[model samples]
Target: MKNSTLLLAIASAMLLQAAPAVAQNNVPIRKIKAVRPTTELTLLDRVESDTHRKIYQYNEYGYITSVMEYNKEAEQWVLDTDNSYRQEYVFNAAGQCTARTSFNVDKAGNKTTEKNKAEVEVIGDKTWERYYKEYPDSTTHISEAFAYDKWGNCVEEILYGYDSYSKMETIRTYNKREYSGPVDKYTDNSNYESFKNGRLLYYLKARGFDDQITMNTNELFVEEFRKIVWQTENDKLYRREYGLDRGMDIQVGSIEKNMWKSSESEFTLNADGTRPVKETVRSYDETGEVKYDYTSHTYTWDDRGRLLASFEYNESPSEVSYKGEYTYADDYAKTLSLREAIAELSCGNQIYPEDEFLQFGRIATSSYYYAEDGDKGESTYEWNADGQLTGGKWSETCITSEPDTDNPTTRTDYGETRVGYNADGHMAWKIDHSITENEFIKIEYLYDKEGIWTGEAEYDGDSWDGPWTKEGERGNARARKRLATRAATTPKFIDDMTDGSHNIENNDGVWNTNGNYNVTDGVVTGGGYQQTLASNASVPANPQYNYTDPLMPLEGEEDEEVFTNEAEAVWSYTWNPQKGDWESEWSPTEAKRVYNKDGNIVADIYDGNQTIVSTITYRLDDDGRLIEEIYSKGGNITYEYLPGTDYLLESVETAADNSRNVCHYYYSKHNYVDPTGIESIKRNDVSTPVWYDLQGRRITTPTSKGIYIVNGKKVMVR
Candidate 1:
């Protein structure tokens, strides 16, 4: 078998289909030992290596109370007292963990402790939990409270966190949910009557009973489609103005309570409740009076629920922003629409119709227009008989208005791409042609015998008659032989190029840095930087590998930690082949960076003379979620998310000329994750294992023997 089969076997073996060992049910695992053989020759000419062990202790209630780790030293197991070495837990009478403490030992034999404690309180219908963590240099306190209704449904939750180092107490999250009681039927003529009358329904702007509708009799459909958020300023300067203390018992003034920014959204749904028909959003700044920034989108859909047209609008100067229109085609000579096919399927008792069987929702053409400079573009698609996208053509026209000329200049660009698929429905090759640039490129995908994608080759021209450039060749014949030899001999620095463990860009059999100078493979050479496996043998004077690119880094120096929570100074040098060593000169294009406490880059300064080049600042909520990013150069970007969630809702980018571009993200509730359906089964030692194809489709009978998934493990069938 090949390495691809072995890799698949290892991944599939984790999904065990057998039942648990009943004999080991009452056996508590006390300790686990792991050993790895090393190649270091011992005094007696025997190999020696270190071993590791982990010891676990459990309380009477079957909860882990303590865990200790040890490493073998000179044939003796010694306690490992490094950072985060040991952990001890304290439990209450109800068998709930109340506190946890981790032990750390420094190089000077000094031990420090980090502790976390949680306290819970139960009031009338609410529960509160306060968690506190104490570190060596800082402390964090979080308070969470939840309120439940009569049916035990949590209706409200509030979370707050206080940071000692930042000396700020902030509201991390606040969310409230409302559910309607069981209703016989919906009688609201303003909203429900329109939906039943085959008219497009719009969500009402009201306080209660407007956001949701009743889907069926005696059932309430409460979906959260819109939300509003308020943000407050909590920088160091703002906290200092309030005279706040480091402790959590400080009082906050009215100035700190005032909202600095706020946003509101409205959503309108279609008739089938499948997708949104329109969305409107507005942002406000509340420094003095409210200043509004608004954007809106309206969509037109066909009878099959496919989008036909869309329009975007901005409210600052009240103008149209963008417009797009779409056209679709079907397999039936474009005569039968998808809506008619769906009607037939629904009447024929088809509850769920698969696309492979229906085959009616293929897009044909799409056109877009921008209102800023009157630019327009269009793309047309072609599909094969199997409904696979075969090729596409894109053309765009750019209009530029000149200050001195009355007539605007227009230029058009065109491009096309074609795809080829294998018998297994996997993309085999792709060719891209740019008529504007007069360039052509082709890429071919390589797969193993089992139809698993292994590598790919790229060609510069249209023909495939010359030597090709390859990448991701981990499972190929040549790479497999090299990997076997590497397994027996350990090198000083692991060469990621041939190890198949890392992704490196290889262009025409040459390893290019792709403009990133920070990468180093721990080897220095006169050519530049040769990332090769280290050995005792001397390197040839003129090696086969050539890396004489001037932009490549010969040496790198840093004044501070690069990616830590502070500023850093960096310098890079090019190779000086004449001097037979690295040059003392630095690249003027190199830059140093300064970071804030949140590890966000605050400034970028030129490294050659230490002059400020550009600055970037970020605003974040208490939960460390970025809200806005400001760039000193030209533009700023702001982000919005769904309330009490990390899912991004929208992002707006404003250019220096005050032109705004907005994007919205929508999620559907119908798409959900299915359970794995893994269950324990009785062990059968005499039964044969089942087999499946590489695509996870069950293989009923084997015509020819090859690599197949058997009993949830990949194996060769003889």
Candidate 2:
């Protein structure tokens, strides 16, 4: 049986305990206080990763103020200086977070000023939160305002775009649900809607107060509608949907689900009330009616409540059926305890939900069988006393049957992985072996005093090797350690190479450094000489970036060097007073980029000295996919896409030769934003008119006037 079925059965048993003590089938349960969100991040004791580690530092108010990343070197944690990634938070006197800022360090180990990349400001204790993003020019890229209901649910959200003349808003309204004791059903009937440019884009209206049925094993009321939904498009009516639930009475060994027969779902819990033995799942047609096909599952568990075996019965003959069995370690409890102890010691602060203490045990080995022509697989796990999952091995065999032939063929494959952990429970060594290929790979790890993983080395061979070592040739490994707390430090030389040392000088308790460069006191100060690496790959070699006539490379397109090829390109810029930034426009001396209203790259201009070298302009279809690209160098490409779809490329045509390439496209599902929040207008492509009702159904016609989603936008039809 699927894990979900077991979870559902457990949920049903828990519900029975809600009845009066004398009438309840199970013993009364103790309730634990829920953890508050504000203190959750600060309460973490420690977090360790192979290459990085983040230590949460909190203030007196128990609010996280700074998150620092450290590097592990020589078995100790050291301040990482190579990567520029840090977050600082501020909280008000009320202990509520007031603001947060993120910063990054560059390859040269220069820490940018705080609040460089993005920031969020919280206002109005319980009602609203505002967020902001900062661009390279120290300007706002976007901002958002959110309003919350008493239940801490976001009820209204407004998004403000920085560069485009567009706005989006979302509003949600909810009603209190009625109580009917243990067997009663309730609904919030929350209404949600989204609008773009003051036009409705999406909506959902859900209603509640449904009659709940319970199964008595004899005339049992076993089904209930949690809520019914109505969906519409362009104010046109579409389809309706219902949310269902199956209730089981734990007192009696018998269970009946979906008694009302409105939806298709049934689950049965064993009289023991601890495990689920069987479950049935049904398919539904687009109209919300149950289909004839269904699936059944049966499960067997050990006396300790651990699932030992499971079987799935498929109603359809075309699909393969599944059966799996599990086993536990001989000393399962002792091993589990040791592992838990190591975890507790490593974290220092081990706080888990109250329910975790009573959770089920882990599996040691598992085997699976595919009944359609006999395919099988199995895996085994190994662990250490430190609670580390040391390594695992898996093997699979496939038996293939040929049509009209009595002979059957088989193939087998297998692999194994072994891992060793450090004293802190961090994985320090790993070796992988593939029996089919007769190949083996090994990796070694190193850390600093702070338990931050800072180095790694790898080797591959046909024969096995010894434990990890530090003297082997390095494998793309690097590390940088911070020297002081926001103070200038002298540059150091390691192996005669200038170490990329940069520092954050404290300016009135605010750590500040230039962004992507060496700077101090709000000035561009030079440190170790910096130079931009030129691209080594030929301009036309990189198909992903090189565009023909009428199509220029997008900004930052050439930054990626596929083969570490670098060539320097001369560049100069003209200042744009209007935008308060240095940019190349009228008298361009370097490359420049321009974006259209929908934020798509519209054009790229390349200038040499005072003359224009080349120009590329891109045209996009209504769905935002590139339809045509024009390059000044003499050639262009035009793209043809299917209409009324996601602009799937149907064909490509080159202007030079008129040669055509065609393709067929398929998609799993259309992407649509939920109505609970505003979706940014990233692409203003034209879309085919489609209608939908609040129930999320596609409607062909409108039966009555109402609010509906048309082409992903809201419309009111009368």
- lDDT top scorer: 1
Give, for candidate 1, the lowest lDDT window spanning 10 residues.
4-13
Task: Point to the candidate with the largest TM-score.
Answer: 1
lDDT of 1 by residue, 328-355 (tens): 7663422333223222222321111112
* Per-model TM values vs. the true structure: 0.34, 0.32
Error of 2 at 218 (Å): 43
lDDT (C-alpha) at residue 696 in model 1: 90
Give every collision pair in model 1.
none
TM value for model 1: 0.34
**Candidate 2 per-residue C-alpha lDDT over 476-516 given as tens digits, one digit per residue, 9 for 90 to 100:** 12222333322343332111122343432211111111212
Which TM-score value belongs to model 2? 0.32
The regions of model 2 sitting more than 4 angstroms off are 1-93, 97-127, 131-143, 147-157, 160-265, 272-274, 316-320, 330-362, 392-394, 401-406, 422-430, 441-461, 464-718
